[model samples]
Target: MDDMTVRGRWIRVVATSLCGVLLLVGTLFGADDDFPFGPFRMYATGPDPNGDAKDSRVEGTDITGRTVPITEGNSGIRRAEIEGQEAAYVATPSRLSEVAAAYAEHSPGAAPLQSVRLVVRWVGIRHARPTGTYRDEVIARWTRP
Candidate 1:
């Protein structure tokens, strides 16, 4: 084969290899995916049992056995006691407050408000599930009290 033809084929091969490497790297570490890459920010993950309370509290242990506090801003803390055959989950007021703060910081366009309602809808199960399997899902809504 001619020297020019040989050189052209080598360039094509190199270009193809570079493209493949780039595509692989993009697929592995691209930031355009819909999933969030940061920490899990879920507060609660179950059913809402409280009818409504202006101030409420939920107490429980985190995945690390540390006390988890769930508190309300406007005297809206309601009690939700989840009972199982062998155990019960109680959410505390301070834990609820932490959830609210995290939500407020993470939510887009959340403004300083007079009051906030934090609702814990789920409690994490410890031994019954895997680590980080239990998620306490919470919802925070700002209102004029």
Candidate 2:
């Protein structure tokens, strides 16, 4: 090969090698920023039944027969109400740190507590009289580690 041809090929190889090196370096150390990972997921499973429960009897033939009672108690009626007002949001690491800082500023003693998972549960509202006002209660579970 001519001298110029050999020099040109050598330069091309060096340029490619330098580009690869720069790419690797950028991937490793370019951005030291935190990104949002997850807000997680939650699901509710169980009964949300309907019908009267009073005179309804759960006979073995009830599932196959047509002579069903319209009673109040045995109707197997149920419902679920979920409140997501206080759900957590996923944020970047820096944002999380800011949140921690805010928590620390407001409640110094509670800052040490580690929040892991949040559990949502159903609250049942029952009425005393037929026209009585309903009551609300929250059923919750928490995970600590």
Candidate 3:
């Protein structure tokens, strides 16, 4: 194998140093939007052992008055997408109409939605273990007008 030239060695050193600096800056100032170089805080920290675990889901009341889950298969929208913009949904519950519309477009034969809501299920925990209890909270809701 041929040896790396002095110029090539200098280029590699500069590139490595630049990468290190970028990582440092990203770690200090970047958010989740800046991945790869930035630290992903989502999994970086552990939750409090005794704190409640949250699970969010979307649900809709159909024309038949049956409440059903609005999953990715039915709505083309994932739970994570909803969780990421949860604050906006809570601020303006009317945005849930978009999810209802998405479900209608994706599942043409399904019952039409009468209302959509964002629900959060909080599971009780103790000593980092489940307590076999949970509560559902409606964070936002939109009824067809």
**Predicted structure with the largest lDDT when compared to the true one:** 3
Once fitted onto the true fold, the runs of candidate 2 whose alpha carbons sit more than 4 angstroms away are 1-4, 32-145
Top-scoring candidate (TM-score): 3
Candidate lDDT (C-alpha), each: 0.40, 0.32, 0.95
Model 1, stretches more than 4 Å misplaced?
A: 1-4, 33-145
Model 2, 1-145: lDDT tens digits are: 5566878999999999987776576555544331112211222233334311121111111222322221223222211111222222122222223322333355444323232211222233234223233332222222222
Per-residue lDDT over 19-38 for candidate 3, one digit per residue giving the tens place of the 0 to 100 score: 99999999999878888778
Model 1, range 5-118, lDDT digits (tens) per residue?
878999999999987776666656644442243222232243234322122334333334444343333223334421121021223323334444553454435442333334
Report per-prediction Cα RMSD to one decimal.
15.8, 22.7, 1.4
lDDT of 3 at 50: 100
TM-score on alpha carbons, each prediction: 0.21, 0.20, 0.93
True lDDT of residue 136, candidate 2: 28
